[model samples]
Target: MKVIIAIDSFKGSISSSEGGAAIAEGIKRVYPDAETVVLPLADGGEGTVEALVSGSSGQLRTASVTGPLGEPVDAIYGIMGDGETAVIEVAAACGLPLVSPERRNPTLTTTRGVGELILDAMERGCRSFVIGLGGSATNDAGIGMLQALGYRFVDDSGHEVGEGGGALARIAQIDASGTRPELTSCTFRVACDVDNPLYGPDGAAYIFAPQKGADAAMVEALDQGLRQYARAAEAHLGHDIAGIPGAGAAGGLGAALVGFLRAELLSGAELVLDSLGIEAQLADAQFVITGEGRLDGQTSRGKAPLGVARLASRHGLPVIALAGSVGSEASALNSQGVSALFPILSGPMTLEAAMDPKATAAHLQGTAEQLFRLIQATAGASS
Candidate 1:
């Protein structure tokens, strides 16, 4: 039998490659002669870079860049095997994890590092870009990133505006004359999932700023700033951007990508799957195994495993999902193409114990072995 293992990273436990290897090992235990192909997978979030890099036999390049708080941080980006495509995760530069609870101020964080990463990639001859817009720590409407790209935001006095979301309202002019000339030749595909608008009740500030440590007053202030920035951006770019779906993702970074970079926003899962050529991988596979940190109702909404299951179903291949924890709504995945769901746990254990890399791998392998045995017995009984 030909079994394809395309599992996502078990977040904080094992990477997608490790998880797929564990499943492959389990399948080997049950069907020693089985042919297994392991493919690392992600939905363009935290592990997106690692997944795409490993899956495509790419290389990772690191650079020193300005962090959300203006501190120097090391950020990593990937160049795929094609050598012309670069994958970047915005979180690497200004993610929420980079800030402590006490210092989590959305008003002060910046996305400057993201621009640095993009510039670095461009300098290396990458013309095609896959950018992940998740886990941001800023509410600056991407102005900081724009600045790094040589777009100057000037106030009424013609002085350049300061950094952070607070300064967005002070912008009176936008000067793009100094922007990198090569940027016009690049193609950007942004991985985005949310549909929040640029500003208002359902916009970036009101919906996501609180998590970045914004208070009610700060949220209001940030919303007003985004509104002002939107007006300026529309006037300068001669296009509407404030009400675009997903314009508010990553604290309006989505809007920046669309309005300034002319990027196409796509479902994160679909983008990653296309990058991996998943349909081609499923062509000859007898079975597909996929999983993630958790399997729940949300999994049906284009998560990696569900995406894999849907594609596998089209090929008439059975798909089994092995999650670290199965939630009450996991049954929802069955209607979306998952043939079976298994939790990678043996018995009662602390969350920390179950999350250990080695333990998680062992449990994943053992679970796959048992699942194969059950399938064998069922096939025999039906025959």
Candidate 2:
């Protein structure tokens, strides 16, 4: 039997690669001769960089770039096995992780560091790029990033707007004469999975600012600042990216990149699936196993496990999933092609205790073993 094991990260515990490894180990326990293939998955969020690097057979390249607050930070990107394409997760530079809890402030944060990374990779000869946009600590609508790329935002006084969102409110004019020339030769795909617009009730500031350490007043201020930035972008770019779906992603970084960098926006899960060549793999697999930190209503809408199951279903393969916790409704996954669902827990345990790396791994191994053994029995009976 051929078994394909694909799992997302357990979140704050084991990585997606580790989770896949454990599932494979369990499959081996029940069918020693079973052929197992491991493909770790991510939904273009926090673990996106590692997942792409691990599953793409990509080489990790590290560079020094500006952090969320202008500090020096080491960021990593991926050059896939083909060696011609590069994958960059913006969070590596502008991520919330780069700022401490006490220091988190969307008004003061910037995505300039992310632009620095993109420029560095382009200079190194990467022509095709996949930029993962998530986990940002900034709400400057990617102006900081564009500034780093040489776009000049000038105030009414003719002085350039300073770094951070606060300065965006002062912008009176914009110029791209100094923008990076290399950008014209590069093709960029922005991996964004959310549908939030740039400035509204469900948009960047109103929805995400508080999480980035913004109080109610700060959220209001950021929202207003973003509205001004969007108008300026429309006036300068001749398009309103702020109204585009997923433009609010990463605190409006998506809109910024779209307006200034001319990037194509795509769903992150779809992008990862295409990059990993999942469509080709499902054709030969007997059974497919996939999972993530949680499986719920959101899983129905292009989440990793859902993407895996959809592909498996296309090939008439049964798809089983595991999760750290299962919430919302199970029926949401039924129509999406999940044949079965497993929570990686033997029994009752605290959230932290249940998510223990070793313990979760053991549970995943055991569950896969049992699941395959049952499949073997069913096949035997049908025979």
Candidate 3:
């Protein structure tokens, strides 16, 4: 039997490649002669760079860039095997994890590092970009990133506005004359999953800033700033991006990418799957195995496993999902073409113990072995 393993990272436990390896090991235990193909997968978020790089046999490049708080941080991006496509996750440069809880101020964070990463990749001859817009630590409407790309945000006095979302309200002009000339030749595909607008009750600041350490007052202030920025962007860039779906993602980085970079916002899972050439791998597979850290109702909404299941279903292949933890809403995934769902846990244990990488891999292998045993028995009985 040809079994394809395309599992996502278990998040803090095993990576996508490791998860696939564990599943393959289990399948081997049940069917020693089985042909197994382990394909690493992600949804274009935290593991995007790693997934794309490993899956495509690409190389990872690291650079020193300004962090959300203006500190220097090392950020990594990937160049595909073709050497022309670069995959970047903005979180690598300006994610919330870089800031301590007491210092996690959205009003003060910036996305400057993201621009640096892009520029670095461009300098290395990458003309196409796949940027993952998730886990941001800023609410600046991407002004800091634009600044790094040579777009100046000037106040009424013609002086450049200071960094952070708090300063966006004072912007009076956007000067793009100094922007990198190479940007016009580049094409950007943004990995985005949310549909929030740029500003207002359901917008970036109101909905996401709180998690970035914004209180009620700060949220209001940031929202006003985004509104002001939107007006300036409309007048300067001649695009109405304020109400675009997904514009609020990554603290309005989605809007900036769309308006300024002319990027196409796509479902993160679809982007990752296409980039990895998953369809080609499913052609000869009899059964597919996929999973993630958790399986829930949200899994059907463009998560990696759902994408895998949908693809497998097209080929009439049964998809078995093994999640670290299965939620009450996991049943929703059944309609999405997942033939079966199983938790990797053997029995009740402390969350910490279960999350241990070695323990998690062992659990995955044991669970998969038992599942394959049942499948084999059922097939034998039918024969």
Candidate 4:
């Protein structure tokens, strides 16, 4: 019997490979001779770089670059096994975690480091890019990254505007004559699950700035600033991507990428799964096991586990998903391809206790054993 184990990282607990290993061990207990393939899974968020690097036998390169508050931060990117595909997560450069809660001001954060990472990868001969736009700490509409990439945003006096979202309103001119020439030869496929427009109540600043430490007043100001930036970009670049889907992602970085870089925004889960070639892996597999930290209504909204489930179902494989927590709404996915959703908890425990790596692994193993045992029994009964 062949079973594929593709579990997402239980964030703050066990990693993807670690969780897969534990599940493999449990499956072995029921079928000692079963073939189990454990894969690293991610949905283009924090663990994307690590997952792609490990899954594709890629190498990680770290570089010191400008952080959200203009501080030095070490950002890591991945060069896939082909050596031409560069995988980058926006969080590595300007995530909320990089700044303290007290200093969390989206107006003053920057995504300059993200551009520097791209430049560094391009210098290394990587022309194919897979950028993950998630967990950003900026609302600058990606001007900071554009600046690092040699796009000049100048005020009426021709002086270059500074970094941060607050500076978006000061741009009167944009000069792309200095951008890297090699960028014309590059292709960018951005893993973005958000669908916010550039500016408005549903736009980037209004939807995401609060988490980056903006108050009500600051959100209004940042939203207005994004409007100004979009107007300037439309006038100067001659393209209006303000109302595009995912344009509000990562604080208007999506707009910048779509307008200037010509990036294709895609679903994070679908993008990662396609990169891993899930269809080919499931060709002869008898069963598929996948999971994430939690299974809720949001899980059905194009999360990694849902992606796996859909692919496996098409191949006529039963998909069992094991999650750390299973909400009532998760049951809705039963008809949507996921055969079953099981919680890993064996007994009640505190959140911290449940998050311990060893404990989570143990629960995963125990849950997998019982679930697979039932599967075996049902198979035997039918036979």
Q: Please count the clashing residue pairs in each candidate, in the order shown.
A: 0, 0, 0, 0
* Tens-digit lDDT string for candidate 3 (53-85): 998899999999999999999999999988999
Cα lDDT computed for each candidate against the true fold: 0.93, 0.85, 0.94, 0.92
TM-score of 3: 0.96
Candidate achieving the largest lDDT = 3
Please give, for residues 113-222, the per-residue lDDT of candidate 1 as tens digits: 99999999999999999999989999999999989999999999999989999999998889999999999999999999999999999999999999999999999999
- Taking all chains together, the TM-score of candidate 2 against the true structure is 0.94
List, residue by residue over 1-383, the lDDT tens digit for candidate 2: 78888788888889999989999998898889888889878877767767777887878899999888889999988887677678888889988888999999888898888888888888878888888988888888888888888998888888998888677788888899998888888888888988899998999999888888899988888888888888888899887888899899998988987877778898788787788887887778899999887888878877888888888889999899998888868568978889989787777899889878999888888988898889889989999
Off by over 4 Å in 4: 380-383
Write out the backbone clash pairs for model 3: none
Clashing pairs in 1: none
The C-alpha stretches of model 1 lying farther than 4 A from their native spots are: 376-383
lDDT of 4 by residue, 7-118 (tens): 8999999899899999999999999999998878998887888787888888999999999999999998999989999999999999889999999998899999999999
